[model samples]
Target: MPPLVKLVLIVVIVIAAVVIWGRVMGRRDPDREIVGLTDAVRAKVSREISAGHKINAIKIYREATGAPLADAKRAVDHWFVPGQGPGVRDAAASYTAGRLTDEGRARISELILAGRREDAMALYAEATGAGSAEAQAIIRTWDTSQHY
Candidate 1:
């Protein structure tokens, strides 16, 4: 075969290969990406239970999206407190629960179940401000129990 003919054939083959690859990949829609069944169900559940504030909304959103860390402090800080929001109590509960490892969940549970909602909420606020993970954990656990 002539050298020019050989070169042209090679170019054509390369072009054809490129075209075929593009066709196969092009058929895939980026927007059609799928979430797992569990995630989808969780998202649906979260949507069913929306919050009034952006923070709680985000917590629900992150929970649905399977966020790695709850970062209750971020959520609490961002949450809108009307005179005081639930974050206050949540923070207090978190603080009490975190500091008193000896007291354990039972003490925090007692605080939460104490029927003194305002006091518990205040304690939570203090604890959250102090950046206490224990407090956040307590709130998270409490919220989970209530939700579940």
Candidate 2:
């Protein structure tokens, strides 16, 4: 084949490949991504993020959704964008199943008082190494188990 013809053929093939790829792999919607994440998974991701555990949150998000780490990180970051999260700007304490420090207990109370339940779970997880669901269970008894 002539050099000019070869070049034209190669360009045409590349263009065809590009068009096919675009059609097969449609653009991902950032706002609509991670749609299958359960509410519990969301709470866990949010909890990890709130407790300053970005990597863990990303890992959890990735594992739960099979999303790439970068995508999970982006989604996790989006969770705290003022109006994006569960409206939690603060974090707090340990849990009964964990180390539950006095400070942790007090902070848990504060978090509960502020109505930031998810953040309270995150805090409990932070101080005591409790899992999200465990932290939530323990937090549920905060009012009933204590004299506060």
**Candidate closest to the true structure, highest TM-score:** 2
| Predicted structure 1: lDDT | 0.45
Candidate 2, residues 1-148, lDDT tens digits: the string is 8999999999999999999896665454556555467656766776676677989988888767867656777888876421123422222332333466767677877887788989988987787676665666656545422443
Q: What is the lDDT of residue 92 in candidate 1?
A: 36
**Tens-digit lDDT string for candidate 1 (103-126):** 343444566666654455446545
Candidate 1's error at 47, in angstroms?
Answer: 12
lDDT winner among the candidates?
A: 2
Instruction: Give the TM-score of each candidate.
Output: 0.23, 0.38
Worst 10 residues of 2 by lDDT: 81-90
For model 2, which pairs clash?
A: none
Candidate lDDT scores, in order, read 0.45, 0.66
